[model samples]
Target chain A: MTAVLEVEDLTVRFYTEEGVVTAVDGLSYRIEAGETFGVVGESGAGKSVAALSVLGLIDSPGRIEGGEVRFEGEDLLSMDESELRSVRGDEVGTVFQDARAALNPVYTVGEQIAETIEHHLGYPPSAARDRAIRLLDRVGIADAETRYSDYPHEFSGGMCQRAAIAMALSCDPELIVADEPTTALDVTVEARILDLLAELADEFDVAVQLVTHDLGVIAGTCDRAMVMYAGEAVETAPIEELYYDPKHPYTAGLMSAIPRVGDDDDRLPTIPGTMPDPIDPPPGCRFHPRCPFAEEACTRTDPALVDPETGEAATLDDDRAAACLEYTEGLSGGLDYSVEVAGGTGEHVEKTIDERDEGGPDE
Target chain B: MSLRRFVVRRALSVVPVLFGVSVITFGLFHLTPGDPVSQLVALNPDVSAAEEARLRERWGLSGPVWRQYLAWLSNVLVGDFGRELRTGRAVSGILWRRLPETIVLGVFGWAFAIAIAIPAGIYAAVNKGRLGDVAARVLALSGVSIPNFWLGLLLILVLSLYLGLFPVLPPSRLPLYHPETLRYLLLPGVTIGTAAAASVTRVMRTSMAEELNEEYVTAARARGLPERTVVFKHVLRNSLVSVVTLAATLTAGIVAGSVVVESVFNWPGLGSEFVRAIDRREVNVVMAITLVTAVAVVLANLLADVLYAVLDPRIRYD
Candidate 1:
């Protein structure tokens, strides 16, 4: 399938007073047509910065130093200001996390959404407003016609997020970059919003690049997942393969960290250490300082992502990969794969793989 | 209660404060070394002792101090400013005639400042850190730092001397009511207004800059709204409360600072009348001018507070 959105070797940096801070370090991923690609990372992992770079919104002192963000086969980085406007809402819409702050307080929700429609699609005021109401209705807002005139402050958090989603879909853009859309919501609201996003993506035939830190969310909504560690992707694979047979140590640690819903365990599994500082990040492998199975070479040389030798039958379409030294040698060799790697072919007669490296904790 | 009620409450509270202010002013004027009666008698050496005593009685200076205070206060409340001892002219009449000139200068000065400052401030903010912003900042800094008196003198020298525009002194040849009289007023008004305009523009620019950085601005950009529409229609209105409040307070300050400007230009305004009243030992006129000035300040501040509440919903009267 053709890639709907492709980010190639994206690097974003900020020239601060102290020094140049690397926010995103050579990140690369893609979302296929009508697929949900989840980029999971912590706050400073440059997820938002990467999204802003796609929209050409990076301001002074912070910039896309090196990257190509291809949205629907068009290079966004090379577009001029006027050209970028055509792409921003008409081609690639965005739904920010903080819905209350994202929407203008002075304008009614319908007015705000209608503005996007008028600018991008050239809809007349009446038609644009009707479209706004229809979009709001589609997003589960009741009394869509009447409540369309209400300001952002009058809406609840969940309702505001829904309105923001409606605004994002106003122009029916091909790609939607939802930056931490459900992070600020309660558990119930988060589930509803996630389900809403999934349903909308299917109904609209639009690709979604969902930026989130929740691994479970990635498992539920994303076709593929990118695990980010200290501004670099540690693993990228189909969701089931990533959860079942994660190869990178960081991905393994992340899986172990998820608490199973029904497990009656007193203590939950956790990964020790914090994300490395972007400025003066660990020289070789950025994750070496925190990796439990770090070798001397792991600290001296960055491990490049390569296909693990899982034989012809073991690989998934020859794309799923991990950035770890253990994966370089034979996968079934006597390596310290303390974490279990679950759900692969059992007929490949080879050396033993660690049984403890099983599937990710179930939700 | 509503904002209108709050303003009334605040305005009413000022009366007691003004009373305290007036008592202090009256005591200071009386406690000074020179006695007005002795000064009057010394001016006319041929006056006999009985004749001088009769003159003092006529002016009510012969009354006990407490009775004199009560009489002066009662007369002031009734709008009967006592006659000046030297010229036998009622101080109220003098103020009524001259107050218009001061009001004229102040109104024109304030209007000019606000007209020029608002757009300049918006430009400076939109083009921040650019050449226009730099130039505007430098102009404002100069306006603030340069003394108004010196600036008035320089304008008089440049515009009056080289161009032969306005008169060196006020247009005393023509009655102040004549049309040509405005030319004389313009130079002084501009001198007083420049500093105020500069300060107002700087404040507006700072506020606009802050509003532009808000998350809503980012969201607006994300929605594909044009730059001009985003700035003028959205950011400017959101940021207006602070700028309007600054301009209002600055205009009030200019009213007070006009004392020096009026003196330098020799325009027959309240400040000139005030200084002359002081020199002539006219206590009633002096006290009345002080009361008027205090009232002007309090009212101006009240107007600013009221406007703030109107412009920003976040502002509420407690």
Candidate 2:
């Protein structure tokens, strides 16, 4: 079966006055139907830009240089504006970072949802309103009927996100692109919103592209995840596999950086340096500057993403891949790392994977 | 608070503002070099002192300034402005006759301003940095920079003297609402409206450009709304919230512009009469016009607050 969304060699750039900034470069990933795929990156990783490119939402001064965004077997890039628009809110709805900002201040929350229903589904205003009210209620908004007419400011941050989720699901789209849906929320509110998003995605049976910087968020939510660095995907694997036996050193660094609840580590380990400037990145691996395991070859050559286990070039069908000289050209010193999962009360048994020797915990 | 309550509160606030204006205006008029009856017959030395005394007493001006001010304020509260010293006609009666002309000019000026500013502003913003936007901006710059009197004279010279498109003076017999009145109104209306329209256009362009970058605009477009609907149906209303505030200021601006504008066009409006009353020290006419204009402008601001609420749901009086 065709994947719900297929992005191949996607490249996006912004033509600023200073020079061209390649925001997203040669990035590719596939999300299967009813799956949650997380795109994890720092601020300048271009994860959001890649997602926006799928819906043709890149405005002027920023252009989708080249890419093939195939949505359910259709190339969304080649479609006309009108055709693309018809598919956008109907087939692939979007939830943005700032929920209140995403919703228009002047319009009522319910009418905003109904507007999409009326536009794409051919439902009359009254019928659309009824459906929208049902959707708001489904998204856990109590008194959805009375709340439908309330503007965005009247809703709390969490409630605004709920209403946004309702609007995204209003047209019953097959794919929902939620870009950091809980970034603006409080920690207490963040958990509830994320759970609500996961629950709704399951209930609706829709694929979600969850873009976030939090590894914990990806750990608890995603089925498969891709790690992006310097506008490129560095690794891709199943969520559990990536967490336990991460193929990329950057991904391994990310795993260890998360503060564990069971163990009392005063200062958590963190990646050494910041991401390289995107406008002019390092010549070799973008992560080489920060990688503790970087060898001479890593600074000399750029490596393509490949299946580390089989030493073959990575494809959308490949189950696991890592873009590193160790996986392709064979590093002189060899890559060594271990992941230890702390078991709280033995419910989640302590498990460790050391790529070099399968050693028990870190010596 | 509800719209009605908001409106009522705003309306009631106008009272104190008007009273303050009345006191200031009365003080300023009294501070002028001459007494009220001086313009009447003070220059006429052939008249006896007793005649002047009797005239001052009859008009109730033979007292200290504060006593006279209290008298004027009391009379004004009951819709009775004192009699004009020159014509002995009721100040209210004189104002009632001349106010319609000023109202007609002001309405036309505002109509022309709004009609021009809204479209031009939208176009300029939608096509920002394009040739059309540059042209509209240049026009707006010229509109703001040019003085109303100079523009008024230029219009008369070009439209009346050269083109003969309109008569040099407003037709005396034509009713203020007549279609022919529109022809006579063009020069003054454009003159009064040019600066306001220009300022409004700049504001509209800025407000719209800012709003277009708002996340909601992108979200609205993401919803598959057509460009026209996204711009007009969604962004336009948000942009107008700020423009409405500027429009309120422009209301007073248009009314004030009429003083000079009415003189240039030789229209028999309160503005020209107001200038005459000022010269002759017709204190009653001056005070009446000042109070009326202050009240009109204050009410205009009230209307703006209401419009702001209508356009933006977030605004609340409470």
Clashing pairs in 1: A339-A357, A340-A356, A340-A357, A340-A358, A341-A357
Give the poorly placed runs of model 1, Cα more than 4 Å off. A105-111, A123-156, A202-205, A261-268, A307-319, A328-363, B1-96, B162-166, B172-182, B316-318
What is the DockQ for all candidates, taken in turn? 0.38, 0.80
TM-score of 2: 0.96
* TM-score per model (chain B): 0.87, 0.95
Clashes of 2: 0
True contacts kept of each: 0.40, 0.70
What TM-score does the first chain of candidate 2 have? Answer: 0.95
In model 2 chain B, where is the ten-residue run with the lowest total lDDT?
B34-43
| Candidate 1 per-residue C-alpha lDDT over A70-172 given as tens digits, one digit per residue, 9 for 90 to 100 | 8878888888888888888787878888988888776778898999999889999999999999999999999999989887877999999999999888998
Docking class of 2: high
Interface RMSD of each: 1.9, 0.7
